[model samples]
Target: MESRKHIRSFVNQTWQLRYGAPVDDATNQIIWSFIVAVLSLGAWAGAVHSGSLPVTYGRKKALLFNNVVAIVAALIMLFSRTAQSFEMILLGRFLYGYNVGLGLSVHLMYLGECSPKKLRGVMTLTGSIFIGFGKVMGQIIGIKELMGTEEMWPYLLAISGVPAVLQFVTLLFFPETPRYLYIDKGDAEGSKKALQWLWQEDNLKLELDDMQKERESTQGEKAKTVKDVLTSRCVRWQLLTLIIPCAGVQLCGINALYFYAFDIFRESGVPEDQMHYLSIGLGATELITVTLCSFLIDRAGRKKLMGYGYLLMGVTMCALTVMLSIKDLNSWVPYVNIALIFCVICIYGLGPSGVSMALPADLFLQAWRPSAYVISGTVNWLCMFLVGMLFGYIVNGLGQFCFLIFVAYTILSAAFLIYFVPETKGKTMIEIMEDFNKLNFKNRAADTEKTDVDLATQF
Candidate 1:
C-alpha cells in the first residue's frame, strides 16, 4: 500500500508537468458556461454534419481532416470581428464539435490499441487528466482580468487551435496504432514495424501474441460497423453500461458548476473580487484529485471507486440543497455550499470523472471497440448537452429542489454500479470478458466456480 501510494504521488507529479494547467476556475460564470456549452454543442453539430457525408476516411485521415477544420475555425474566430457574430460562432462551434466527437473516438481507439493490456486503464485515464487540465487552463485564462475583456473571449475560444496543431504535428512523428494497421487495414508488415517502434524487441512477441488472439476472436464476427454497434446485444449492453455512468457523471452537475463557478460562488455569497481566486482554487483541487485518482484507479478497481464517488457527490449535493432551502440565505450559506461543491468535485475527480471515460475500452473486445467508442461518445455528448441546457432552468424553477434531481441520478448511478458493473482491475481484456461471461451464466454453482477460478487467475 505504501509503495503504491508513493507511486501514485510520483505519477501525479509527472502527469501535472505533461498536461500543464487545468481549465481556469475564475472566469465569469455566464461566459464560461456559454463557451463550454457552445463547444460541446458545436462538437455534436459537426459530428452529425460530417457523419452524414459518405467519406470513408480512415482514423488518421479523419483526425487530420478534423484538425484542419478546427484550425480553420479557430483562425476565423481569431481574426474577424464578424466571426464574433452569434451565427458565425455557432458555425465554428459546429465544426469544433464534430472534430471533438470524431477525434475523441479515434484517439481512444488508437490509444487502446497502442497501450499494453497491463497499463491500458491508466493510459486511458491520462486522456481524461489532460482534458481536465485543459478545462482548468481555460478557466484560468477566462478569469485573468487582462483576458476577461470582451475582446479576449474570442481569443480564449481560439486557443484550442494550439492543441489541434500539436496533435496534427505529433501524428506525423508517431507510428499508427499497430492494431489498426494489422486488423483494420490488414497491413501485417506495417503493423509489425509499428509494433517494433512502439515496444521493445523483448516485449514484441508477447504483445504480438495478444494481438493475434484478439484478431482471431474478432475474425468470424461481422467486421466492426455502425450496424453491429446498434444491433449486437453484447455491444448494446456494454454501451449502455458505459453511457449511463458517463451521463450520470455529467448530470451530477459538475460541468455546470465548473462552467458557472463564478456565478455559483457569487450566489453562495463569495465577493465578486475574490471569485476568480476561488475559482483557481477549485481548478487546482480538481487537478490534484484527478491526478490522485488516476494513480489509484487500477489499484482500487473501477466499480468501488465510481460507486463511492457518486454516493459521495450525491450526499454533498443533498446537503447543499438543504442549506439553500433555509429561509435566511445567510452569508454562511454560500461558504457551506462552496465547501460541499468542493467535496463533490474532489470525489468526482477521484472516481467517476476518470473511470467512466476509461472503462468502455476496458470492457469491450477490440473488434467492437471503435463502434463502442462512437456510441459512448455520442451518448456522453448528448448527456452533456442535456445537462448544460437544463441545469440553469432546474436551478431557477425548482430552487433547492433542483439538487434532488442530481441526488436521484447519483443514487441510480451507485445502484447500477454495485449491481451491474463488473470489476476490471488487473485483468487482461480477454480475462475480463471471461469473468463477465461467468457472472452472466445462470447456473449458480458453475458461475461461482468460474468466478473463483477467474479471480484466482488474475492474481
Candidate 2:
C-alpha cells in the first residue's frame, strides 16, 4: 500500500499527474503523502476491529469479507481516472491498507489453526512468503515499460484486486479451520469433519485432545476484548513476546534498511539503468531467503534463526556504517558497500522478516489468539508508520550514524531474546501458554521454583 500509493507522483507522464489532478499543489502534496501515510493508519484502524470480526464471524468468513475490501478499493481506483477525482485515490489506498492489515493477520491465524503442529511453522509462514511475492510483483508491474506508463496507471493501481478475486473463488471449497470450529464454536462433530477433510485422517483424537487441554487452560476466561488485552495480568508475558517480535520486525529497521538499500546502490556509482535490475536482484534475494526460511524454521527453530539473524544483521549494519563513512576512501569501497546492503537485506529475510510474523500464531491459543493478532497487527503497522515517517528526519539529523540506532535496537532485542525468549519450536498452543505463564510468574520465586516451567520464557 505504501509503495504503490505514489504511482501518479513517480510516473509523471501519466494523465493524472499531467493535467488531471483535481487539487492544487499544497492539497496534492497533502493528498499524496496523506494517502501514503494513511494506508498504515488504515491498517491500524482496521486492526483495532480485527479481533471482533474473527471471533464473531469466524476466520474464513472474516477473510472473505476482507477480500471484498480489496475489490471495492480497486474499483475505486479504477474509476478515479474517469471521474477525474483524486479523493478516490485516497479512499482506495485506505481500503487497500485496511484489507492487507486485516487479511495478513487473520490469514496467519487461520493457517496456523488449520495445520498440525508439525507443519504449522511452514504453513503460517506462507503468509509472509506470499507478502514478499506481492512486493516483488508490485515492483515488476509498476515498471514503466510494463504497467507504470501513462495509459496504464489506473490499471496498475487496480491490479491488486486480482489476488483477492482468486482467493474469494478458491476459499469456498476449504472448510473453516478445524480449531476455530472446535474451540471457538464448541462444535466437536463439525470440527472432526473439518479436520478430517484438511488432515485426511480418520482419527483426530490427538489434535482434539490438545485443543481440549487448551480450552481448559482458559476455562473461565471470556473472549478478551482490546481493553481486556490491556488489563489482563495473565497475558502480560504473552503480550510482551507478541509485541516484541511484531514490533521488532519493523523497528529493527528492515523497512528503513530497504529505503537505504536503494540509496546505497545509487550512490555506489552504478548506472541508473542497471540500478533497476539491481533493485530486482535485492528483491529476489529477499524472496528466495524468506522462502527458504519457511522450510528451515521447522528444522532450525525460530529463536535460533532470529537470534543469529539479528546478530549477523547487527554486524552488517555496523559494517555498513563504516562503509558509508569511508566510501570515498577507496576505489573498491562502493562495491563492497552495495554488497553489504544486499547482505543486510538477505540477513533480514533469513530471520526476523518471517519469524516475527509467525510469533503470534505460534504463541497464542484460540482464546487469546484473536486479541493477540489485534495487538500484534496494531503494533506492527504503527511501528512501520513511525519508521517511515521519522527515518528521513532521523537520517538528516544523524546521517550515517542513524544505523547505530538500529545496532542499539538489535543489541537490546537480541539480549532480550537470549535471556527471556523461549524456544517455541514443536510446541502445542497449550504448551506455549504454559511457557508464557512460567515467564509471567518469573519474578515470584516463591511460586515458580518448585513448579515446572520453561525458565527461558520471554518476559
Candidate 3:
C-alpha cells in the first residue's frame, strides 16, 4: 500500500479514462485519498471479526482462509485497468485491507503461541521485521525501472497475490500452534506432535508442563468477546497497555511522514526522479533498525525499548520541526532535516512499531488473547484510516509544525509506558498477569488499607 504513492498518477489516468474527461486536481486528490484510505476502512471491518475467525477455525486455518481474500483482491487489481473501472481499484484496495487486518492479528496470535517463553520477544518482533521488509520490497518494486511505469501499474497492484499463494501452499504442511492445540483445543498429544514438528525436539516435557499449567488456569473461560475485553475491570491495565502502544503506532506520524516524503525530499533538493529511490533508502533504515531491535528486545526489555524509544522519537521530532523551520537559513539545513527524517523512522521501527505488536500476545492469556488482538487491530486500523484521511489537511494547516502533533503524542505514550506498563520479557503469562493485577486493583487495595487504619483508630 506504501507503493500507491508511486502509482497514483497512473491510477489517476485510469480514472480519467473512466470519467471520459480531464480530471481536475481537486477531484483527483479526493479520489486518490479515498483509494488510499479505503483500505483502512476495510481493515477496520476485518479487524472486528479477527477475533472470531481465529477462535472458530484455529489460527493456521484462519490465516489460510484469509489468504483467499488476498488472491481474490489480486485478481480484481489485475483486471481493474483493463476494465477501465476505478471502482475495481477501490474494491481491490478494500479487500487487501481486510486481508491485512485479519492476517496481522491472527499471524501474531499464531506465532506468539508457537514461541517459547525464552524466545517469545525475539519471535514476536520478527513479525515487525518482516512488515518493514515488506515496505522495503514495495518501495523497491514500485520504482520506475520496475512496475511504477504507467503501463505496468496494474500488475504492480496485483503482485501481492503471489505471496498469498506462496503462504497458502507452505502453511498447509505446518501444524497449528502447539499452545492452541493444547490449551485451546485440549489435545495434549496433538500439541506434543506440533511441538516436535515445530521445534524438531523430542525433549518437550517442560514446554508441555507450561502449557498444561496455563490450560488448567484458564479451565472454564471461553474465548472473550470484544465487549468482555473492553468493559471488564479485571484487565483494565492490560487494556490500557495494549491500547496506548497500538494506537501510538499509527498516531506517531510515521505514516504521515511517508505520505509527505516526496514533498520533504523535494524541499531538501532531492531530484523528483530520485525521490523514489530515496524512499527505498527510507524503508531500508527501518528494516535495519527493526532487525537490530529483534536482537535487543529480550535484553533491553519491552518497557525501556518502547518507553525510551518514544522519548527519543519525541526529541527527534522536535529537532525535525526546528530543522524544517530553519531550512532556508542555510543550504546545509535541508540536509540536516533529511537526516532527522531518517532518525525518526529508525526510532519508530525500534520501539512502538515492533514492540506494540507483541503486547496483546504477551498481556492476555489464551481466552482473552483474541479479543485483545481485536481491540489492538481496531485501534490500529482506525487510527490509520484517520491519519490517511486527515494528514493532508494537517500538512496544509500546520505545515512543518505538523510533526509537533506527533511529538506530543510520542512523549505522552512514552510516559504511559514508563509509568504504567511493566516489562514482559522473560516473564510467564501468569507472572505478567500478576504484575498487572497490582495496578488493576490498586484503588481497592488502597481503600482496604484506609479502612484498616480507621478500624485501628476506633479500637
User: Which 10 consecutive residues of model 1 have the lowest summed lDDT?
Assistant: 1-10
Q: What are the TM-scores, per candidate, against the unseen true structure?
A: 0.81, 0.92, 0.94
Off by over 4 Å in 3: 1-26, 449-459
Of 1 and 2, the candidate ranking higher by TM-score: 2
Alpha-carbon deviation at 75 in model 3, angstroms? 1.1
lDDT of 2 by residue, 270-359 (tens): 777666666667788889899999989999998888887878888889988998899888878878988888888888888888988888
Better of 2 and 3 by lDDT: 3
Q: What does each candidate score in C-alpha RMSD?
A: 11.4, 4.7, 2.3
Cα lDDT tens digits, model 3, 1-459, are: 334654566556776676777778897778887887899989988888889999998999999999999999999989987787778989999999999999999998988999888889888888899988898998898777777776788888899999999999999998999998999999999999999998889999988887888899889889889999899988999999999889999898898777667777898778777877888899899999999998888999999999999999999889888878877888888778778888889998888889998898899989999999899999999988788778878989999899899989999999999987889999888889889989999999999999999999999
| Location of the lowest summed lDDT over 10 successive residues in candidate 2 | 1-10
Task: Report clash pairs, candidate 3.
Answer: none
Error of 3 at 39 (Å): 0.8
